[model samples]
Target: MVKDQLTQIYTQNELSCMATYSIKAVYHKLMGEQSAVTWDKIVWNRLSIPKHRFILWLAMQSKLQTTAKLAQYGISQSDMCLICADAKEDHKHLFFACSYSKECLKQFKEWTSITSASTDLQQLIRNIQNGRRSKFQKQILLVGLAALVYLVWNSRNSSYWQQSIPSVNYVVKHLKAHTKARIWAVLPKKLSTKDYQWFNEL
Candidate 1:
């Protein structure tokens, strides 16, 4: 119906329809789309997953990478991590397991006053969503998490393409810049204490 027609249009030009159909699909639910929370935008942009496929993939992967399965993509099964050459390339390593990422999370926890379990991606998202915080706080956390994921993935690509290593601070800095631009453009006001602190340090 309207959703299908809008989806077709969205596929053709995301920016042109940003104000009309996309925003409406998000905040207004003109079609059979889900309600837009900050998490919705965070997840959509960060993962690059289609809206319809996100939940299904979450159910399957729980946010952790199954090395055995993903190995078909040319990444070694034993190569558990692409960032920290020392760690296994799994969800924890990518997000919380690596030294740099661990440090970043430490700052994040201190700033946000939120704690996350050493779980897979799906669990982490759930933890952030169920957090006892304001909608604004929740959106910030989602943005951070999304930024972290996207940064790690890009770092992996860098490692492979350039045959070089990336520092923890480097990835953190990149994520901060990217997230800052996107969040500032779409949302009102400056970042919170935690996000601002991280951005400043970056």
Candidate 2:
């Protein structure tokens, strides 16, 4: 290695990849390539709010405490979901497979006119990757995914401690109103009237 460098080589060293390359860039590149399914865009998206992003972070880490996890940790013996009070609560079921969660996600999709092509969380996040969609469409879908996960978790905890759960319609209403407010804040004047109409209908 020393033989290949200049006379001053003994005085200094440098990253060998490229002059402009960075460790952060390499880390992100490696992360993007290592996954069996595409996940970088799913959680790294900027359209979602900070709190929602935090929820996705926990979810990807498998850190959210589903009843099944609690049981495995000896924290609780019951594995049933507090929301549905039927199926055992595991990460997969709590996020997507549970009937109650499915209902919430379904309403969110219907209200947003997204009609997600996949039912499960991972597949749904991947389905939104179609590059043909408008940029705003993609952004909104990503934000919607984050919002649904956060909403389901929030409602579950609320039901657990409050002894009551919000109706699916109520949750959907709140989601729409929140999305509408966010839309106005983000919509740029460069977007055409038609684009504005599309968001309004969403």
Candidate 3:
């Protein structure tokens, strides 16, 4: 049956078939592979919150309303970060380099044992989702990383627009609370006791 299907798939003359295959091969080859960091594989599926997923998607694209982006649109008068007030506010700096954000992220890293989260957005994600980790550990790390991004963006917005950002303690408290709640409510039911124990370690 497979042989018949293959024969039908190449029913045309060899010259025509080869030309057709060559065109498709050339097109894909010309397109090549992207080496840029992509958060897509773990960003959508298995995420517990739609809002968190959306923010993470925007973050991966560097589309958030950091001062640099606002300036690019001719809206922002000051380039200083609303959260940190010292460095220019771009997606990369606002997300991880700001002192305020760094402190908050530090607490989260300590909580989850991911100490190498970088200020570079792509590298930060790579640190969390590398090949050397276990499946359950990777899941925990991805979720924790998303929670950090969401919380960072949220706190930045609050400070930028509302004249207040939650204390670092509050931000960490809320992330752990909301994430733990989501895990219980939405994570796969097949997780074993050891998985549960590992999650607790995070």
Candidate 4:
């Protein structure tokens, strides 16, 4: 079967008799090419914490096991948000729509000076990317946003298992610390004086 598949691909590409074998060519032909997503840089930013990036990636894809998803799978009986306890718990509400999360987002925006009015995760990312902020500023904002998502998800889990949710201020404080430290550790050497000063004030 493998030999037959290889022959099919070879014929489809109309390879010359002298063409060299390429694993890359074979792989792309087998799996097809995927288009790039706009959130790729936001979720995979180099300055963001690895675990935070991972959670952001999952949250961006709506794959986090929120109570709404759990209820749909019969693993949970309650779909109410653990943090707010007033709405269905899902990726959308857990990120910023819930009162607790909205407060956290408000604090984050104040810190980063992100002027976009969006509370939705994906839309906010698009806004940041398209905004007029400098590259460094945008990176800092993305890092902070990623940290918020991670902490908010953690708050939800705590509410579930520990029967406690962290205050929005507590989450925001940690989010600022984590994002600041992460950016400082990998800070680019060529940052402009203006950007550096802005970061220092944050």
Clashes of each: 5, 0, 0, 0
Off by more than 4 A, model 2: 1-37
- Among the numbered candidates, top TM-score falls to 4
| Full-model lDDT, candidate 3 | 0.77
- lDDT tens per residue, model 4, 1-202: 9767788767755666527777887888888877777787779999999999999999999999999999999999999998888999999899889999998999898888778888999999999888988999998988999999999999999998999988888999899899888989999999999999999999
Q: What is the TM-score of each candidate against the true structure?
A: 0.55, 0.76, 0.78, 0.84
Leading candidate by lDDT: 4
Please list the C-alpha lDDT of all candidates, in the order they appear: 0.58, 0.74, 0.77, 0.90
* Candidate ordering by TM-score (highest first): 4, 3, 2, 1
Which candidate, 2 or 4, would have the higher lDDT against the true structure? 4
Model 2's lDDT to the true fold?
A: 0.74
Model 2, 1-202: lDDT tens digits are 6334322332235345356745575565445655464676668676677788888778867789888889888998898898998888877887788888888888877766666656677777767776457777777777777877888888888887898888878777777766667667766667767666787777
Task: Show the lowest summed lDDT stretch of 10 residues, model 1.
Answer: 47-56
RMSD to true structure for each model, in Å: 11.4, 6.8, 7.5, 3.2
Off by over 4 Å in 1: 1-42, 45-80, 117-119, 188-202
3 or 4: which has the higher lDDT? 4
Tens-digit lDDT track of model 1 for 28-47: 54356555443444465442
User: Distance from true position, residue 7, model 1, in Å?
Assistant: 35
